[model samples]
Target: MKVVIAIDSFKGSVTSLEGSAAIAAGIRSVYPDAEIISLPVADGGEGTVEALVTASGGRFVSLEVTGPLGQPVAAAYGLLGDGRTAVIEVAAVCGLPLVPEAARNPLHTTTFGVGEMIAGAMRQGVRDFIIGLGGSSTNDAGTGMLQALGYRFLDKDGQDVGRGGAALLDIHSIDAAGALTGLQACRFRIACDVDNPLYGPEGAASIFAPQKGADEEAVRLLDRGLRQWATAAADLTGSDIASVPGAGAAGGLGAAFVGLLGGTLESGIGVALEMIELDRHLEGAQLVITGEGKLDGQTSRGKVPYGVAQLARKRDIPVIALAGSVDHGAEALNDHGITAYFPIVNGPMSLEDAMDPAGTRYRLQATASQLLRLLRAAGRL
Candidate 1:
C-alpha cells in the first residue's frame, strides 16, 4: 500500500516535517511494508519559508534588515535547492508581532525590510522569487519597500518623501532611474489570498490597517495616503493597480509587486502545492493524510488540508485530516474533499499542555495508529 502524508505545522507545537514523521511512524507500525511519502506543507503564511525550504532540501539565509519601525531586526528567507528560486515571507520582518501593542501604528510602520530581503537574495544570484504576502504591520502601499529597491518617491519639490505610510501623502512623482539594474531580469510569483483593493472602503488600508495598529482617525489618514500613492503609482506604471484584486495585501505590498514589479498574484495554497510538486507524488497513492493546527470553516479557503484533499479527490484517493483541534464549522470540510477528520487530542487538556511539542507528537502517533487500525478492521487497508 502507498500513503502520502502532507501535514502543516501545528503552530507552536510541531513543524510540518516533524508532524509528518510522527504520523508516518504510526502507519509504519500498522503496515511495516507500506510505502510512505512525506511532504511539508503551508498556506503562504508564517511557516511558508520553512515548509517550502525544508521540503525542497533548501537552505535558509539570515540577515539583519530594517524593521517596520526603522529599527534593525534579524530575518531570514529561503533559497530553494534548485539554486535559482528564493522564498520570502513579508511577516518575517515587518509582521505585527514584532511591534508592541502600544507602539502599533500603521502610519509609522514600513516594509523596507522586505525589500532588503529581496535584495539580499538577488545578490546571491537568485532571480526566481516566491514572496508570501501575509501578516504585515504596515499600510504604506509598499512605498517603503519601493524606496529600498531604488524607486524614489519624490515630494512636489522633487525631494525624497522618506519612508512610512504618512510619507505617501507627500509623494508627487516616482523616479525609477536609480532602480537596481538586474531587477528587470527577476521574476516574482506572489503568494496572496486576499482580494482587497489598494484604497477605499473595501481596500487595504480600510480593511487591514486597523489590525496593524491604526485607530479610526489613523485608518482614515492611511486610506487617504494609499489613495494618493495609488494615483502616483498609476501615473508612473501606467496601470490602474488600485482596483486590482489583492492589490492591498500585506499593506499594498501586493501593489508594489504586481503593479510595479510585474509579479503575478496567485492563491497561496495553490502556489505551495505547485512548488512542492504534490501532483507528481500523488500518482498511484492509495491514501492521503493532511491537516493543520486547526480545522474550521476557514479550512476550505485555500488552506493546506483543503488543497491536498482537492487533489486527492481528483485521483479518487481517500483523504484523512488530523488536526490539532476541530471546531464546529469543520464538519463542512466533508463537502470540500476531506473523507474524514479527527482531532489529535485524546482527552481534555489545557491549551498550553496540548501545544507541547512532545505531547502533540505522541498524540499524532496514537491517533494515526488507531485510524489505521480501524481501516484494517474494515478491510480497507
Candidate 2:
C-alpha cells in the first residue's frame, strides 16, 4: 500500500510531524508491509519552516534577534536542503509566545525582529525568502521591519520613529534605497492564508488587533495608522497594497512583505506543497490522509486540509482526514475531496484532557487503528 500521510500540527498537543508519525505507526500495525510516505505539513502558520525543512531535507540556521518587546531573544529560521532558499517564520521572532500576557498589546509589539532575521540570513549570503505569516502579536504595519532593513521612518525632527504600531502614525516617508540593500539579491514568497484587506472594518486592525490584546480604542488608533501608512507606502512604491487581499495578515506585515520586499502572497498550504513538490509526488496515489487541529467552516476557506483535498480531488484520490476535533459537520469537507472526517477523540473529554499531549501519541495511534478497521470493512484498506 503506497499510502501518503499529510497532516497539519495538532496545535498545543502534537506537531503535524508527530501526528503523522503516530498515524504511520498505526498504519504499519494494520499493514506492516504498506509503503507509507509520511509528510508532516504546516499551513504557512506556525511550525511551517520546520515542516518544510523536514520534508525537503533542509537545515536550520539559528540566530539572536529582538523580540516583540525589544528584548534580545534567540530564534531560528530554515535553509532548504539546497542551502539557497531561506524559510522564515515571523512568529519565531515576534510571536505572542515571546511576550508575557501582561505585555500582549498589539500597539507595543513589533516585527523588527523578523527583519533582523532576514538581514542575518542575507549577511550569510542566503537570499531566497519564504515568510510564514501566522500567530503574530504585533499590529504594526510592518514599518518596524522596514526600519530595520533601511527604510527610515523619520519624524518631522529627522529622528527615527520608535517601535510598535503607534510609530506608524509618525511615518512621513520611506527611504528604502539604503535600508533594503541586504535583500537585493533575495527573492521573496510570503505564505499567508487570510483574505482580509489592509485597513477597514474587516481589515487587519479591526479583525485581528483585539486578539492581540488591543482594546477597542487601540483598534481604532491602529486602523487609522494603518491607513495612513498604507497611503505613504503607495506613494513610495506605487502599489495600493493596503487594499490588496491578504495584506492585513500578521497585522499588516503582509503588506510590508509585498510592498517592500516585493514578495508574492500565497496560501500557506500551497507554498508548502510547491516547496515539497507534493503535487508531483501525489500522482497515482490511491488515497491521501490529511488533517489539522480543528475542522469546520474555516476549512472551506482555504486551510491546509482544503489545499490537500484539492490536490486529491484533481487526482480522483480518496482523501480522509483525522483531526483533534471536528467542528460543525463533515458535509463541508466532502466538497473538498474528503470522503469522511475522523476525530481523534474516543470519548467525552475536556479540552485540557484532549490536549494533554502526554497521551496524544497513544490516542492518535488508537484512532488510526479504528480508521483502518472501518476502511477495511469498506474494502478499501
Candidate 3:
C-alpha cells in the first residue's frame, strides 16, 4: 500500500514538516513496508513560504525592507526548486504581527515593503510570483506598494502624496511613466481567501479595518479614502475593481494588483498546491492524510485539508483528516471529500499539554496505528 501525507502546520505547535513527520511515523508503525510520501502543505497564509521552501528543496532570501510604520525590518521570501518561481507572503513585510497592538492602525500602515520584496526578487531574475495576501497591516488601497514600483500617486499640486491609507484621500492622478519596466515581463499570481469589495459595508474598511486597529469613526474615514482612491485608480486604469470579489483583501492590495498590475487572484490553497505539484505526488496513492491545528466549517473554505481532500477525491483516494481539535462544523468536512477525521488529543488535557510536540507525536502515531488496524479488519486496507 502507498500512503501520502500532506499535512499543514499545527499553529504554535509544529511546522508542516514536523506535523507530517509525526503522522508519517504513525503510519509507519502500522505499515512497516508501505511506501510513504510525506509532503508539507500550507494554504498561502502564515506558513506558506517556509512550507513551500522546505517541500521543494528551495532556498530563502532575506533582506531588510521598510516596515508598515516606515521602519527597517527584516523579511524573507522563497525561491522554489524551479529556480525562477518566488513565493512571497505579503504579511512578512507589513503584517499585523509586526506592529504592536497599540500601534496597529491601518490608516498609517503601508504595503511598500511588499513591493520592495517583489522588486528585489525581480532583480534576481525571477519572472514568476506567488504572492500570499493574508495578514496584512495596511489599508492604503495598495498605494504604498504601487509607489515602490515607480507608480506615482500624485496630488493636485503634482507632488507625490504621503504614504499610508489616509494619504489616499489626496490622490488625484497616477503618473505611470516611471512604472517598473520589469513588471511587463513578469506574471503575478495572488493567493487570496476573502471576497470582500473595495469600499462599502462589506468592503475593506468596514470588514477588516477594525481588526487592524480602526475605531468606528476611523472606519468611516478610511472608507471615504478608499472610495477616493478607487475613483482615481479607475480613471487611470479604466478598470472598475471596487465591486470585484477579493478586491478588499489585504486592505485593497487585491484591487491594486487586479486593476493596476493585471494579476490573477485565486484560491490560496489551490495556488500553493499547484506550486508544489501535489497532483503529481498523489498518483497511485492508496490513502491520503491531511489536517491542520483545527478542523471546522472554516476548513471547508480554501484551507489545506479541504484542498488536499479535493485533490484526493479526483483520484478516487480516501482522505483522513487529523487535527489538534475538532469543532461543531467538523462533520461538514465530509461533504468536501474527507473520508473521516480524528482529533489527536487523547483525553481530557489542557491546550498546553495537548500541544506539546512530544505528546503530539506520540498520540498521532498511536491514532494512525489504531486506524489502520481497524481498516485492516474491515478488509479496506
Q: What is the TM-score of each candidate against the true structure?
A: 0.98, 0.96, 0.98
lDDT of 3 by residue, 118-175 (tens): 8999999998999999898999999999999999999989999999988988988888
lDDT of 3 at 317: 98
lDDT by residue (56-115, candidate 2, tens digit) is: 898899989989999999999998888888899988899888889988898889999988
Model 1 weakest lDDT span, ten residues long: 140-149
Q: Give a tens-digit lDDT track for model 1, residues 1-381.
A: 999999989999999989999999999999999999999989999889998998799999999999999999999999998999999999999999999999999999999998988888899999999999999999998888878889999999999997888898898888999998799999999999999999899998889998888989998988888888888888998989999999999999999999989999999999999999999999999899999999999999889999999999999899999999999889988998899999998888999999999999999998999999999999998
lDDT of each candidate versus the true structure: 0.92, 0.86, 0.91
For lDDT, candidate 2 versus 3, the one ahead is 3
Clashing residue pairs found in predicted model 2: 9-16, 149-179, 150-179
Candidate with the greatest TM-score versus the true structure: 1
How are the candidates ranked when ordered by lDDT, highest leading?
A: 1, 3, 2
Superposed by TM-score, candidate 2 places the C-alpha of residue 2 at a distance from the truth, in angstroms, of 0.7
* Model 1 vs. true fold: TM: 0.98
- If both were scored by lDDT, which would come out higher, candidate 1 or candidate 2? 1
Candidate number that wins on TM-score, 1 or 2: 1
Q: Which stretches of model 2 miss by more than 4 angstroms?
A: none
